[model samples]
Target: MLELTTEQVAALAEIDAKRFVEGVRADLCKDDPKLVDDTTFSSRLWRAFKAAREVGIERDENLVAFLRVEAYAPSFYEQPAIRAWLTRPGRSADQRFHDYLRVVRWHIEHPKFQGGLNNGGSGSAGNRGGSASTWSGLGARWRGFIGRGSGGGSG
Candidate 1:
């Protein structure tokens, strides 16, 4: 259920791929400067994250489908092609691109990020629902639109 906060999405929009990945790593790191380092894994993941963010995937609620690539990606968050793909100006609007933003949205907010793999990679998944300003949050807002608990009742 984890979702992207609007602030997170806005911040991501400004960074280049390298910086975007660094931000994801840092988010996984939970403010621990010691963990940031140069490595292929970090670089590739950054590329994937940057690509996804570009397309509006930065804030989706679905987790498993987002990561599946089912063809959305040629590889995981680490592939040279994905790097090129993300930066290609004409490639920005593809539907698959959103998968990156969506997964990272779930990734950083994972309870593990509250601790642990903020040490290595992101931590194990947890079931915390979406934050305000995202798809899952949008659903919640919709319920309110229909008055979920207000007894105003929805059609």
Candidate 2:
């Protein structure tokens, strides 16, 4: 008799695909260590994102509004493409949501970033074609997110 916690329920209700996939991966990794392999996790994430696409569209207003408001803060956190995509005129919310999904699906299917130390690339720690610093930031953020027990209830 498994049940979703308040945070897990909110993540689903809000269509937080990243959170959902990470949570699922953590849970699966607990049961079977091999289940958290990059390939398996990527596949599971793709499936989860695809299955939840419709829900993402249905609940687009939350993300759309958040991105829109963030755009006004004069900060780098506001992605220009997202702002333009969500705020473009003469388009319905659903249409915008679909367009957003199209971009998301494309990224998920064919990530632009493929060469990394973890991916078995031959780049050294200091020579990643200007991506080393980016990976540093990503590493910290990933460690924090995964270490926070986001896999559901108290763990």
Candidate 3:
């Protein structure tokens, strides 16, 4: 059996994270050509990854969901309602992510939730012109990513 040192493990993890970030960057750019011209896009994506990790959403699928949401509504995770939901007890990371998706979807579908009526409407999906097709597209992409991952695991 091959045994790795702590430093080696850390280095490998870093490498994996870097690769993941780059892959996500490429996908984002492909999805939105404008991002390709934005030099700060990479940094923003990296920050989103860090933010997701900070919230215990480290799995690739969950991270993808977070990134998609962040792309649609910048600074979404910082909203009080979203922040509270993320910190709610008794749920695993996957469960929280799924529930968060439901909440976001619900908000998007309801017109009353649009225009900042709730949560100050700052960075809310409604504030970002979140149409049903747009959010449904995001949900479809998230489902695709989740489908490719192992059935269960937090990280």
Indicate which candidate wins on lDDT: 3
The lDDT of each candidate is 0.43, 0.42, 0.65
Q: What TM-score number comes out for model 2?
A: 0.27
> Model 2: runs farther than 4 Å from truth?
1-77, 112-155
- TM per candidate: 0.25, 0.27, 0.66
Instruction: Indicate the worst ten consecutive residues by lDDT in candidate 1.
Output: 62-71
Candidate 1 residues 1-155, lDDT tens each? Answer: 87889988776765554564554555533433323452444644554554565444544322223322311222343345445544556544344456444444554445355334447745544343533223333333333322342455332
Estimate, for each residue in 13-69, the C-alpha lDDT of model 3 and write its tens digit: 878887898897787767666557877767777787877787778667888878766
As for candidate 3, its clashing pairs are 116-121
Output the lDDT of residue 1, model 1: 85
| Winner by TM-score | 3
Error of 2 at 139 (Å): 13
Model 1 clash pairs are: 57-98, 57-101, 57-102, 58-101, 69-72
The TM-score, computed over Cα atoms with residue i paired to residue i, of candidate 1 is 0.25
The TM-score between candidate 3 and the true structure equals 0.66
